[model samples]
Target: MPHLIPDTGPQRVITASNFVYTISSGLYLTAGVLYFTQAVHLPAAQVGIGLGIAGFVSLVMGMAVGHLADRHGARGVYAITLVVRALATACFLLVDSFWPFVLAVCAATGAQAAGVAARSPLIRHYGGDRPQEFRAHLRAVTNIGVSLGALLAGWAVQVGTRTAYQLLVVGIAIACAASAAVLVLLPAVMPGPVVDGPRWVALRDRPYLLITALDGIMAIQFKVLTVAVPLWLVEAITAPHWLISGAMLVNTLIVIAFQVRASRTIDSPAAGAGAYRRSGLAFLVSCSLLSLTAGMPPWAAATLLMVAVVIHTIGEMWHSAAGFEVSFALAPQHATGQYLGVFGLGAGLAEALGPSLLISLCITWGRPGWYVVGALFTVTGLIAPLAVRRAEYRQRFRPTHIEALGKAPVA
Candidate 1:
């Protein structure tokens, strides 16, 4: 019988790493805020400020870390960052004061950023011609791991003791350490042919940057799910509060079931652009349906919200697949790390700014805000194809050595 998963050693290693890291992240996601406020005894505002500062610092350092991966090696840098992340997470156990907590958070955030910066380059190196599929598999496994971790975290929340929080932190640290060990066992990915250019070449690539910005805008789907929808359901709509958790469950299930299949068609720029267009349409439908839920009977609103979430989840799968395709397709082979780092800025920006933007527009402004978000998706999706085309055109004029990296396979 054929292997159910990828049979290659590197693919297995990478998938395991994703699973372990996401489990660690999941353990923290539901517990971090509580640990800070209840266990560390930090004020809510201080905790938020510390986390915000850490996120900003990580964002700023992402590109430099990517450059480091390029100069050194993606695998080596990735492994080292994982170890650093583990150490930082362990330090959280010692944080009794606000300043100590802030420092630990920053260290963990920076290490995570560096690890993420190296991930795509490592994938590109090992995944051969099918990096998107490999990435999709990793995502699927990550979802499964996170689901398990979240369940475990729920148990910790139920206990809500200092010992529980400490155990969660220790588990995360151990998971990170295990992931680093797994990463070390993978085959080394030799750097691509060096391109002669300034260290910040990605910063000057205007077309690529535009594509990254559009990708970021589409990525607000995450914020929509976690922040906007929960508030909208509880405050704006008369729907059941259970719908929020239901929606998340739907999303996770759909991603696990369909993400890899959706990614199969996204091997080229045009295909990636098409996926973006489909995602935009889905987002528009979901948002439009969601807006109508206000003032409806609870049953009707709940049904509508579920439908909208299904559509939104479909869009999410496509958007993620397209992201992998476009990022890999447009990046010069020699500068993969830098390009991925720059591309990462869109996600960082979305996470940082999406909550405020969505809340201010969708929640505060009511129906008008949802409309704005839908329009934003439509406009960005329409522009993505054009941006990819322009980037491809630019690639045509690059040095012969750069072009030799070969184009993504035509689907």
Candidate 2:
């Protein structure tokens, strides 16, 4: 037993979370393409509807599942959810009909919801009382997992698309199972002494809600990069497939390296808000860079796209960390999971709506679409700082300056 186990620290948490997310990444990489290919056998409208239904279900039910984790505890919930997710992945091998695909996606989405809900709250619970640092660390770990997943998926795709899908299902099942087994052996949730009264009261805080809304908007950038950018690369610019893949890989690798370090500079809500403001500015600049891509040759466009992605990726990491920190700091003792779930809602909505909106803009505006997206991002990003300022003024409470917040506690 001693030889089998390693030290429990930041590395341990990162490893565990990375394992879970890596599996998730592998599953998602193939699931969408596989479902669509299978869609070729069905009506195109049905395929779209089926995927939409799965996403909607995940968006709605994810909060409920997260709430349950808050009330019930994370360990048992994680174990059970992973088991279910694994079983659902296995069932995908038999999904021949449209209805079956729809149902399978719903199951997988639910599993994803439950799994993330459990994992994030657990990180917060263990990170003493400073939720922001904990949340940032968790995000860093997950991003690292995502990078690893992309690499593995790239290899899987090269083997053969069908073979990749089959292996993805199998790998996802095994990974989920392994994570559940390991998570069960960890310590119980340590959210500190339960203070008396309602944790739901955290929802009423003005700054917290505003921050979450900003988080939702910032999340759209990710939606653009993954869904919108790829389509533009192929259809609009007619760029080579390798350019698209390489750019994404570059973005992922950079994120994994810098997220934690960059996030460390943010300390208080006000400082976070400042970071958010900077993020907004960076986004606008990135969008401007993207707009230039439309006017360039294919190779030149790919280079510009790569540069824009790098800038956008930076803004994403900053805002993501700041958003999590804000949620963790403002959440009441007993309701960390609940408030976090509400924070998670912003992300869920972005995932649901952002892709379609970006894609639509791309299709409708053509070369001009990049500018439209740039304008939207610039406006939204600018709004975040103003909202932060409004929250500061309306509350009549000056946030604690980062100078006095003390050093961040180690994991």
Candidate 3:
């Protein structure tokens, strides 16, 4: 079958942007695996707290860094964030104790978050009127990088924990530095409008706030499953580590295969809303299946978990791609960076709250606890359809067609 990827246009900027995003994905993937394994070793009570601290810091500071990117230029901000990230990734190698690991993760998280906030809006600079497709392609490239890094790290773990940790740190540092170099090579792309006073007021826009709120709620399923499900597989069901790893590998691979296709298919406002709504429904079903894990035999529970993970992963691809497209369309030509920064805040809060809430529920209510979490997702998904119907949403949103891009207002 033939493929239907979007045109990336003639700018070297798009190519450079993709390369930069690739480095971020690769670095984060390697570092994150190590972080997760190490975090899991700590006392269960402390895990949620540690993740919360890192998330909250990233949420607040990411916006500030992004604000800088909006005022200056994304390329300039990218240059700074990459160097900081490289240094922070290297620090992970030196973290021996729990407290140090916690602190290191926080710094590393902030750097990654800042890089993302800067890069997202930067796409608008390169993409002209086709930011949605451009951003989708960037995300697809990032996913490819993530798969490579995860595979490398997965093998590294088998060799020895310390060896894997050292290799990841060194490799990620190299990637980060290279990304900075790529940013250096790109031409300056200017922000459309220069705000006279404090630009934080840009966040007060009602429509933008509503979309982010919806996004935050959608984040719960992914965060909760990745963190809480693995522990459940091991402690509650006593499944093998290999099974957990396999499930994740499957999830990543499936996403890589279908994500871009799904993105292309659902590039319309109604389609995007439908995907979110369906994803919520899927989450409800997955959680219901997961709840059954408490009642099933070990082998059966592992199988059920795998099934749930697959369904959840598909929904994830739809939700992520659609959300990216919608957010890009909604951003004003002049305030792209500021808008993306605020969007990042919604994601940050979700990352902070989702896992912590799931972990607490799991600790308190045991296996079936996630069902309650699932219900919350179901309720929140309801907002997406409403968002699609609103006139403000339609103003920035459109059907999946070349005509839509041409209609995008250029500064």
Candidate 4:
């Protein structure tokens, strides 16, 4: 088995950074909605609208911030974004009305979006030749840290006081500040050689853009698990209410235990494409099983749900592993941040739009909706290899003039 913890200096720093940042995000995510509705006394609609707008703004600005990271160093951009996040989190304390709350949400979400734009470049820079392995280790550490943070947040929720909410928000800000300090300790990775090409080359890469869109579609699994499953169990199936929590627990445990092992084989573009194919099969089977849960006996429904969760978690692991490999492997070394930023749009859009889309399809349309979702996964997974191959071919056969323009060699 590969080491769960990284042995190299840069890898260790990356792992620590992921752990701390994810922990802080966990604490904030668990408490932010409650704080907005209860302590800040914002109506639920206002809160939703404000956050939705902020999320959209973040998505739109991601590529621009990535260009900044490519010009500056990823490490510096990441650290600056952390500090910005800390300040934005602090602004939550001053929110008394809808407009103020919206501004705070925008600031926090924008900083987070920019930070994400910087993150993958930092990882690719520090991960040496085995970025997938390093990413797997960081993912495992993230699960552990987020789990702990969630448990701690649970205690605060149980306290159920305004002061408790305030404390959680304050803790998130302090954590962000501390994480920024930790990032400063990381050795700087210089930006790649300057490329004099058009600033929006990623936008012009058609094959890569298609691959990114497919990635976004695959990411709908997150919404399926979080939104669709709960609604289906409570409304459509005769299963126990606790089964919702049980399914998530199984997913979390499996990911923590086996994600690194699953990622061990994904070392090249072809291998990454193969992993995506496997993930599609897993998702299809899991969705098919889930569609069978309606009108079943409680015991049988519970069993089916558990089985589906396990299968879905497997797909989740493989998809993540393959995504990291393909994303890094296909990106030009000089424009890593820009490409990654563009790639992130798919995930951002999925998270932004997936809940309503999946919930309507799965819960409202029932089994047929699940079948459609399954087909979507299968098609995206199958087409991913073709997209990767096309991109590779383009890179291999680029015009001599384009090559001479200093396209950084792929890693």
- lDDT by candidate, in order shown: 0.85, 0.66, 0.69, 0.83
lDDT agreement of model 2 with the native = 0.66
Stretches of candidate 1 off by over 4 Å are 1-4, 405-411
Residue range 99-134, candidate 4, lDDT tens digits = 999889898998888887787777777777787678
lDDT of 1 by residue, 265-316 (tens): 8889889999999899899999999999998999999999999999999999
Better TM-score candidate (2, 4): 4
Residue 101's lDDT within candidate 4 is 90
Give every collision pair in model 1: none
Give stretches of model 4 more than 4 Å off: 398-411
Least well predicted 10-residue stretch by lDDT in candidate 1: 402-411
Name the TM-score of candidate 2.
0.84
Off by over 4 Å in 3: 1-51, 91-105, 159-164, 195-198, 238-241, 297-299, 388-411
Cα lDDT of model 3 by residue, 56-101, tens digit: 8888776688777766777778678888878887887776666876
- Could you give candidate 2's per-residue lDDT for residues 89-120 as a string of tens digits? 77777878788878887898778766666655
Error of 4 at 377 (Å): 0.9
Clashing pairs in 4: none
Rank list by lDDT: 1, 4, 3, 2
Q: Give the top-scoring candidate (lDDT).
A: 1
